[model samples]
Target chain A: MTLQMTVSPDFPPAYIAGWYIFNTWLQRQSGLPIHLTLYDSFAAQRAVLAQGGIDLIYANPYDAAFLVRECGFVTLAAPCNRADEVVLAGTQTGPVNTIEDLAAGTVIARTDDPDVNLMGMMLLEPAALHAGNTTAITVDSYPLVAKQLLQGHAGIGFFLEEAFDSLSALVRGQLRELVRSRISVIRHVLLAGPGVRAQQVEHLTTLLLAMDQDDRGQAVLESMNLSGWEAHSQEDTEFMIDLMDTLDTQVLPG
Target chain B: MDGYQTRIRYFDGHSRDALIREHEVPFPDGRLIVSRTDTCGIITHCNQAFVEMSGYPERELIGQPHSILRHPDMPRAAFQDLWETVQAGRKWHGHVKNLRKDGSCYWVLATVIPNVRHGRIAGYTSVRRKPARSRIHESIALYARLREAENP
Candidate 1:
């Protein structure tokens, strides 16, 4: 049986292509039939998950927690990006040295992602740096935001650590990290639908956990900006669940 | 790295003369007490805020379980819930009361997340911030009830 998997389109188009290619490799290696879908919007993805049209999913921490809480999806393994926080990057010699430094300058970011975007704003808003203001430029993706910052079009750029990690070494070398948020529960989460078999889940989890040890697997991971896959733990899942609950109850808008 | 050190410096020597007290120490705004632990919960690294607020020296805290700061008044179920929540690969947040070396107590709003590396949980991190007074009061009442339930 083919496992229907979906990835949210909140990522840049290239990363979506990377995920497709990664899943295609999984199909070849695991000897299991697999079909991958990339939803254009989170709502479309949620609709498919609600209808049980998807059996496996790769999603950000917040959406994964939501699915596990609301749709009975099982937390499997997650790609380890080695960063659990949002990051602010700028040229090493630039005047933007702190969150407050961006108060009057253009801060380029991808505000489309509620997860990272909310995190970025949470750090900046208290300092009176509003994203809605002209000081904040909403870029569409990580690479583009990095480009904007590197090209000196903006004084600073806000994105997740993985996004910064994905940049070419030359770009990273030229930029300085001004801020990094506190760690979140997990990065992206891999989850299974109720209909998936136990053995299948176990096997896939094992395959992913070991994916980085091989050269070909490492190449796939690089394209998607991941270090490796790690086993999902019960405690980590519960932590994300609690975090989501707290975020929901908070008066702050993400 | 730069901001981390700057924040750490703020809390480094603040508790030098702390004395035992029934009252809670007022937490400064915008600073977070941060600690990182191995999967087994052994402290690996911590910030200055953690060192000061926990009432333990950096040396003493380095290899100890975070429970080193667990207050006697805290309910076991609360920690159990925290452990259960985070072990499930989710972020956990709640009010926590902790003890210091001088037998003093303090309250915080804590958020904990796992550090996943090489496809396994390498460690966990807890970031504690100043909590609202009313929230602490509510937690105090709830914790008291939970403690009574545990003993009864």
Candidate 2:
């Protein structure tokens, strides 16, 4: 069967072509037939996943836990030194300067990115804001989240730290960072499903680890805004998953 | 005939109104009505029990928003809590009143969980089973108050 590969939908949209290039390179190196599918939303991607249509995936931290625990997927690699973090921001001209300044009824613009939204909500706990007390407006992408804040449609916004940093300087300048999660252990991971043979997983892991040393691999990495790939041990994966579960339980309903 | 026509209105392409039979479809014991939806609440899959309980064929349920089965009497805040809990990757349990295609309704104790793929939430799976009639009565009264508060 032709192996199906997909990346988490939360990746920066500009790097979409980069993922395709990477997929092509992997197929060539492994001498295996691989098809790359891009999904517009988490729900759309998940529809296919429910049917067991995916074999290889670049997953976000939240999904990683599920794939590991429920789907029996094994970690292949993770982006080197790239931890997923969330930034809570507001318009520079907005009255809320800190989390403490936020109050009930604050309109929060965000994407469906689960982990980022979870962290953003946690940051607001200090000020007693939550899903019940505050209103949440979901947008399609991080840029749209910024647009909502800039247009005064929302009082604050939740963003993936990488997405926040990649915003154009003009837009970035108008936004003031209220806070950012400092959790460094959580990061996106590449995983191979249970159907992938052990030999194939080992071969792919080796190829990924060597990508930074070659010119073509370096170019692909640069396109994807990745420094390199590092092997993620099962223990490390379990630890992160546990941390995520712990965090999930700590969030109390408003 | 004119008065009867006035009692019928449309909902989800089916005519429903105050005069539509208000009755219960008692959930089958020892069976679960299972359905899956994408993160956006679009139904992706449903089991035979769900189809039977909902009075909707598999074709009608799939690809439709889960809200297609939402009874008008169900309070909005209850769903809000469900969404908030599942979006955070947590499980939620509650009693829900679900409308069937024929305009009848059923009560179930429902549990919903977010399905994760590659470290991100992809969809949700909801498994519902028979709820005690006493518990259903409690929900009925509680939801009535909640609906009143919401509308007021």
Candidate 3:
């Protein structure tokens, strides 16, 4: 059977293209008929997950928790990058230095996508008044969040630390990190759907975890900005559970 | 693009709990660490006490995931039970040890209530008070046992 492997459109189009290449290599090595799929938007991905269309998924912590809670998906392994984090950034001269500095008058800018926005929300919630004064202006991309900050259209910007670093040096020099959501091991995971067989799941998990030991797999991991995959542990599940609770509770009673 | 902005407002209350210290800080009497989260546990509103007790500035805590204060020593089972109880629309109360920015710890007696809106659970309200020292001690031992169970 051709197993459907889906991915969240977390990265730019170019990196996603690399994911397809990695998928082809993995398919060959595993001898499993795996077809890679990517969604343009989280809404599209949600629809796919809801219908149980995908056999495997590469998903972030928040989405992983959501899928496990609502869709019976199980994480098989988590992929790690050298430095995994999400941060809130602002121009060095911007009046806001702390989360409290983002009071009513301050404007917050972030991407409209849920995958990123959810992290923004998680990081921002403790600072966001269960009820209070802060406005979140959603743009289409991380670059736009930076643009909004640079142009003085927004007081605060939310982005992945790497994405912010990818900006020009001059732009990079202009920004200061206000606070970071430093989940030490923040990374995406390979998850199995409700329909996958346990033996196959175990086999796939072992193959991916040992990928870094081989040459072809090392190349794929390098292209994807990953060190390697590790077996899922109970701590991983606890982290997600806490994450889900955090996301659920951000909105206070009106 | 022409600039467009939206405004959010918060009520003000000034209160400071115990400061972060190297030793375990007991929750101050009458000082409560309270916060509300959407059904998923993302903090929305927190009283000044919650921010102060966490040893994190108020602004940093507002839009953060509640797990931002998760102490590594905390067992997953405690939270799993909390979620199961609250998700079922029941009030759940327990003792919790949370980590502060400086790595110090504090214990709180937390009661989580499902906030209902229009006959459905809108979110949750977590009100935490100073837990009794005896309860804190019991929790410490129990949590240690739970962690041992997990590792074993």
Candidate 4:
């Protein structure tokens, strides 16, 4: 009967705007009872969702993977409203052309949000991702790092797309994209549980997808880039579950 | 009329409530603090006892999380284990260090239970009592170092 949604702190304001529009659409359209709760990280949200305390959750692919498979959650669909990734250069240096092109001890300032997209990028070159090394500075927000970089604190910076969009104009202008990532499918997924029936679940999805095509839904879709909802498969949900299982096992040095 | 009283915060509001609201378990020094959290460790409430024990006024505790009381003396495994057990709808009993309003500290022997609804967790509930000397000594020694590291 309740809908619990969890989203990242990165680009949260944008999604808040998107929700006001989208939730209003739902209020007018099918009268489906839906609500949202936002968070700063995927790990924190995933833990709460796993307790089976929530009815539905809006999670990233990485977190969703674990919730649907390892926990008792089931994925309904994935959304493509906000998606972009970029490697931002510091003011004193140019962006690296590739992960391999960076100097062995190249300094890269990072902002680590609570999701895997950025962490996944770091995994692409883990050795290059030490947190405390003089060459690597990990912060919680991109603009902070961008500010530090612009002030000549760090040599270079990496900004995932959402953060890249909101950086100060000064930081944005001073920095150039060293490289851009392929548009990754970062979805805001809706996952459900055993209490929800198939018919009720489909009704919610159909109403949501059809909303965009309608005049009211169209407005929300435009603002949020919420194209439509498609059925999610077990495959789409497995990767995160496997990763969480790995993280869980490796949590302590037992 | 101005006799000294054990001050506590109401879970739902800012007004101070008396510790007369009896709990299933009686705490030493009448210092019983109760909290609610969904199985994930998010806090839902902190009774008047919690405010008195924490030295934080109700305004500071309302809508804040339960782990807001997390003391460094506690091992990471304890929290990890607490999450695992409560999410499984089990109750946990242990010792804890609670930070006071002015950044001083106190100790507690605590029990935490999951709020189960329809065979699932709705939230978690916790009860605390004054910690024994043995528990306090170990935790305080551990926390002294933690606070030092955090401050230094």
Weakest ten-residue segment in model 3 chain B by summed lDDT: B6-15
Cα error, residue A142 of model 2, in Å, equals 1.2
Runs of candidate 1 with Cα error greater than 4 angstroms are A10-18, A40-44, A89-97, A100-109, A125-138, A143-157, A165-177, A182-184, A213-225, A247-254, B1-127, B130-152
Query: Each prediction's TM-score against the native?
Result: 0.59, 0.62, 0.63, 0.50
Model 3, A126-182: lDDT tens per residue?
A: 343422456788777777888899899988887876777677787778887876654
lDDT of each: 0.70, 0.81, 0.69, 0.55
How far is B117's C-alpha from truth in model 3 (Å)? 27
**What is candidate 4's CAPRI-style docking category based on DockQ?**
incorrect
For candidate 1, write residues A181-220 as lDDT tens digits.
Answer: 6544546778888788888888888899999999999999
Candidate 2 error regions (>4 Å): A250-254, B1-152
Ranking by DockQ: 1, 3, 2, 4
Task: Using lDDT, give the best candidate's number.
Answer: 2
Please provide, for model 4 over B61-104, each residue's C-alpha lDDT reduced to its tens digit, 9 standing for 90 to 100.
Answer: 76776766654344445666777776776666666665454444
Worst 10 residues of 2 chain A by lDDT: A245-254
Candidate 3: Cα lDDT at B69: 70
What TM-score does candidate 3 get on C-alpha atoms? Answer: 0.63
Candidate 1: give its CA RMSD in angstroms.
10.3
Q: RMSD of each candidate?
A: 10.3, 17.3, 14.6, 20.2
Cα lDDT, model 1, residue A39: 79
Docking quality of model 1: it rates as: incorrect
**Which candidate gets the maximum DockQ versus the true structure?**
1
DockQ of 2: 0.01
